[model samples]
Target: MHTPYFSDRPAAARSAAYRTLWRWHFYAALFVMPFLTVLAVTGTLYCFQPQIDPLLYPGRLLVAPATTPRLSEDDLLARAEAAVPPGSRPAAAAVGSDPERSAEFVFRYPDGRQHSVYLNPYTGEMLGTLSVEQRFMQRVRMIHRKLLLGKPGELLMELAACWTLVMVGTGIALWWPRGALTWRGTLWPRLDWRGRAFWKSVHAVMGIWLAAGAVAFILTGLPWSGSWGEQFKSLATRANLGSPPGVWGGSTRQSTIPGRQLARPANHAQHGDAVAGGRGMDGMPPMVMDDLPLPSTPWAVGATTVPGSGPAGGSAAALPLDRILDIVRANGIPRGYDVAFPSTPSGVYTVSYFPPDPKREHVLHIDQYSGEVLEEIGYDDYGAVSRLVSYGTSLHMGRYFGLANQLVCALISLGLAGMAITGFVMWWKRRPQKALGAPARLPTPVTMRRWKIGLAALGMVFPLMGGTMLLVWALDSLALKRRAMR
Candidate 1:
C-alpha cells in the first residue's frame, strides 16, 4: 500500500485525497451552514442593538429633553420604590448618563425574576416596565448564544463553531493553488462560463476570499462558549496569564453577599438580621437581585462583594449616589456609563463603563459606607487572554471603529449567507434524486488511513467536533457494511 500505491501512483493518491477532503467538507457544511447563517444574522443585528433599541423602545428608553436639573437620587429612588409591583422590591438603580435617557430601576421578585422600570429622571414620571428577557436585544442575544436552551444549546452552538473552523480548513485545502496560477478562473470567477460550472467557480472563489473572516468570527466567539470558555478562562487564570495580577485581588469568584440580593427600602432586610426581616410581600420569599444573565461584559472585575453598612442606619451612613457619579466623571469615565446602586447597605456601588473604544473599558466598585474605590479594573489592567477577549468581542460586535466596522461585518455576514446558499444549490444540482449525494468512501487502506489521521488531528483540537465526526463515521460504516451484505 505504501510503496507503488503512493510513489508511482502519486496521481491516484492525490485524486483520492481531493475526494476525501470534499466529502468531509460537505459533511461539515451540512452541520455548520445553518448555525453560520443564524450567527451571522443575529450577530449583525446585535452589533447594531445600540441604534436599534432606541428606535424600537423609544417610550421606555428616551425621555423629554432635559430642560431642568434632574431629580435628586434619593427622590428618584423614593419614586421608583413606590412604582414597583406590590410583591417586588427594587434591587438596583441604573443611572443613565444621557440627559435625554430615562433612569432604569431593576425590581426583583421573591421567585428570582427581575424586571426594569424606566422613569423620567427630570419629570419623576414612570416611563415603562420591561422584563429583561423580553427586551428585543436580549432575545437576539439568547438565540445567538444558546438558542434559548441554556447549556445544551450553548454546547450545540460551540460544536457548530468548532466544526466551522474545520470547514474553513478543508475549504482552503480544496481550492488551494495546485499548479500555475490562473487569475482568470481561479482567483476570479469565470463570468463567461455558463450554468453549474459558472456557479461552482463563483462559490469556490468567494468561499476562499471569505474564509479568513469566517475563521476570525469563529475564533473570536469561542471564548464565550460555556464549557470551552470556562475551561480556557480557568487555565488562563491559573497560569497567571489572565487579567493583570492583583487587579481585583482575586475577587473574580462569585460574591458571598451578592449586591443583586439586596432588598429595597420598602422591603428592607437589615444586613445582619435576614431572619428577623419580614418575608416577601404576601407569603413568598424575600426578593433579591440575581446576577445578570448577560451574554458578554467588557469589565474584567467579575463580582466584588459589597461591604456592610457603617454604624448608623444603612441609609444615612452610606455615601450619596450623586457623589460616586461625580467621582466617576472626575476620573474621566465618560457618559453612557452605567451606575448600579448598591443592593445592600454594605454593598458597594458599581460604576461600569463600556465605551466605543475597547481600551477605555472600566469597572469601579465604590465602598457604600466610606465612598472609597474598593476594586477598580480597566482594559489596560487585563491579562493577555482577557485583553484578547475584550478586543475580539469588541470587533465581533462591530463596536471598534464605528460605521466602517459595522459595514465590514455586515459584508462578511452577507457574504457568508450567500456562500451557504450557493453551496447548497451546487450540491443539489449534482446529487442524484434517490441518493444522499455524499462522496463515495475511498476503498484503499492507504487513503482511509490518511483520512483517519487527519480526522484524529482535528478531533484533538476540538473534542466536540471530533465526537460528531466519529458518530458520522460510525453511521456511515454501518450503512455501507449493511449495503455490502445485502
Candidate 2:
C-alpha cells in the first residue's frame, strides 16, 4: 500500500489529525464556495470599470478631442441644469483632464434620486443623462458590497468575508506540502490521474496558487464592511492613527441643514425656504462632508464636519462656480477634481481630487461667501494608519499601477472562481447518495495544540469570526460527546 503523506508522524496520530482537519476544511468549503464565486465574478467586473464604463455608454462618457478652449465651469453647469428637468439642481460637477472625456454634472431630484448629466466640454452640447444608481458599474459595486440588500446584506457579506478568511487558512493547512513533495500533484496537477483524483490535484494546486492574493483581497475589503469596518475606523481614530486631529481647520462651525431637506423640490419659494433658512427641519443636523454625492470620497475625512460660510449677511450672493474653480486651481488641485455645489447659505463648496495614485488625493472645503479655503486635507496630512489604508484602498481597486494592476487583480479573481468550481466538483464526485457526504469525524479526540493557538489568535484579530468559531466549536464538541455516549 502507498504510504500516507504524513509519513514522519505515527500512523494513528496522523490519521486522527488529518481526518479532523479534513472535516473542518469540508465545513468551510461548503459555506464559502457559493459566496466566493459570486465575489470573484463581481470583483473581476469591477476591476475593469475604468475601461468598461466608456464602452457601455460611449455617447455619454466620451467626446471628440478639441484643441479649442472648453466652456467655462459655470457655463457647463448652466447647460447641464438646463438639460435636466426644472426641479433638478446641480449637486456636483466632475471635470476630466482628458479632452476626449465629457464633463459630468450630478443632479439631485426632489425625491432624493441622483442623475448624471453628460455635457460636451468644448461645445456645451448635452450628451445624455443616466441615473447614478442604475449605472452599470455602480450596480456591480452595490452587488459586490452588499448584494443590494442594504444593511442585512452588508452583515451577510461581512460574515462571508470572515468565513472566507477561515476557509483560506484551513485550505492552506490542507494543501501544505507533506513528506517528499514533488511537482506532480503539487505545483502542477497530474493530468494522467483519473476522475476524483485528477480534480483533487487541480483544486489543491489552484487553491495554493490563489491563496495569497485571496487573503490580500479579503483583508483590504474588510475595511469597507459595515460592522467591522466601522469599529476599526473608530478604534483607529481614537488612537490618533487614522484621521489625525484638527484636520477640520480649527473651525467649530456646523450647519443645521440636512441633505434631505435641501433635496426637496425646488418649487419652494426660496432656496432657504426649503431648509427653513438653514436652521434645519425636524432637528436634523447640517449635512457633513460625507453627505455630498461626489464620485469618490476619501476614507480619512469622510466624517469631518462641513464648515459654514462666514458673515451670513455680508453679501447675498454666494461665490460663483467660476470663482470656486479659480480657487481650486490656485490651490494646485489638479485636473479631474470634482466640485460639489453648496446646498445652503452655511454650506461650503466641497472639492475632492482623487487620482489613480493615493498619494495625490486631496479634499478642500471652501467658504461659499468669502471664497476662503476653510479646511484642506491632503494625502500627506493623513496619519500613518490612514495613509496605509489609502494605499490599500487604491490597490484593492486595482488603480495603483494602471493596466498591469487591473490585469493582476482580474487573474486572481478568476483563479479564485475557478478554485471554487473545482472544489465543488471534487466534493460532488465523492459525496454519497442522499447525504451531505462530509468527511467522517475521527473516533477519538485529538490534541491539536498548535492549531488551536493559531485559531485563537485569528479569532482575536477578527471578533466576528472569533464568536462564530466558538459557537461552532461548542456545537461540534457536543456532537462528539453524544456520539461517544452512543
Candidate 3:
C-alpha cells in the first residue's frame, strides 16, 4: 500500500512539468539571444570609452600640456569657425579644463549638419574636424540602441529587453536546484561531464551568476527606449519623480534644434527662427536659445528664449562675452564650464557646467543685456527621480568610479555574451534534425492552471510582454482550429 503523497503526479508528470517550463525558456531565449549578443559586445566596448576615445581620435581630442595663458574665448571661437567649411557658424563650445585637452567648438551649417572643430586654447591653433556621426563611439551607441535602424530597431531592442526578463525568470525556475543536484552542479558547471550535459550545466550556472547584471543593463537602458521609455518618462514627470518643472528654469515645450541637425557641423541653420532646444546625452531638458545666432550647447540646454539683453546698446548694453566669462568665473563656475555667446542683439549668454561627477552639474542662463543671472540650477535642485536617474546613467556609462567602473561593467557585458553562446550551443546540440527541438508539450490540467496564473501575473506587470504572449497564443489557437477543420 503506497502512500498518497508518494504517488501524487508520478515520475512522468513531474518530468512533463519541467519540459513545459523548458519550452517557454527556449522560446524566450529564441527571441532574445541575438539581441543579447549584440548588446553584450557593444556594451563592453562602450564601457571602455574613456580609454578608447582618446585612442580613436588622438590628434583631435588630446593636446600637449601648456603653461602659457590660454587664448580668449573669442579668439578660440574665431579660429574654430575659420577651420570649418564656408558659411558654417559656431553654435556652442565644450571647454576642457585639463591643460592637455583641446577646446571643442561646435558649428552648424544651413543643411542642419553639425561638426566640431578642436582648438588648442593656449596657442589658438586648430586641432581637427570630426563629425559626430563619424565618431566611433557614436556609431557603437547607434548600433546598441537599435542596430542603427532608428525607431523600428529601437522597438525590436525594447521587445528583446522585455523578453529577456522573461527568459531570466523562466531560466531561474529551471535552474532551481532540487533532488540530487547540490552546490557542485548548481553553483559551478560540471566540467568533467561531456557532450550536452556539460553545456547544460555551464549555461545554467552562467545564467544564474549573470542574471542580476543583465537585468540591470536592461532596466537602466529602458529609460532610453522610444515607446515604453517615453511613456514612463511622462508618468515619472507627472508624478514629479525626479524632475521638477522649474529646477532648470526655461520653457520646456518650445521647439528646439534637432540632435540630427546638430550632428552636421557644416549645415547652416535653414530656419532662422527655429529655436535650438532638446535634452542632451545626460537626459536633462535643454534651455532654448531664442532667435539669437548663439552657438550650440549640450542637449541639456534644450530650447530656451534668452530674455532680452537690456535694450541692445542702452544703459544696460549687454556686457561682452569677456565680461560674461568673468562673471561666471567669479560666481563659482569651475574652469571646465562652457559659455555660449549670444547671436541676436537681445539674445542672452548661457553658461553651462557638467563634470564627470554628475553631482556637480549646474547651468546658468545670464541676461546678455543687463548682465543679470536669470536662472541657475545645480544638482541639489533636481527632484528625487532625476537625481537617481542622473547618477545611475553616469554609472551605467562607466563614468562614476573611473577605470574600476568600466572594468566591472565590461566584465558583466562579456559574461552576458558567454551565456548567450553557451545557451545556443546547448540548444543546437540537443535539437533533433529539421525540428525546433522544443520539448514535447505534455502539460497536465493542474500544470496548465498554474501556468495560466503565472502568465496572468506577468501580463499585469509587463503589458508588452503579456500582449505579445497573448498574440502568439491567439495565432497558435487559430492555426490549430484551421488544421482541425481541414
Which structure among the candidates has the greatest TM-score?
Answer: 2
How would you encode candidate 3's per-residue C-alpha lDDT over 66-182 as one tens digit per residue? 878988877887777777778875666676677888888777765656677898878987788887656788789889989999889988888888888878988887887766676
Task: Give the TM-scores of the predictions, in the order they appear.
Answer: 0.83, 0.89, 0.82
Q: Please report how far candidate 1 places residue 182 from its true position, in Å.
A: 1.8
Best by lDDT: 2
lDDT of 2 by residue, 293-399 (tens): 77778887765556656655845798889899899999998788888887766667889998878888988988888898987889887788888888888888899
| Pairs in clash, predicted candidate 1 | 242-383, 243-383, 260-289, 307-346, 308-346
Per-residue lDDT value at 187 in model 1: 78
lDDT (Cα, 0-100) at 410 in candidate 3: 88
Could you tell me which 10 consecutive residues in candidate 2 have the lowest summed lDDT? 260-269
Query: What tens-digit string does per-residue lDDT give for candidate 1 at 21-61?
Result: 88889889999899888888988898888789899999998
What's the residue-level lDDT of 475 in candidate 3? Answer: 64
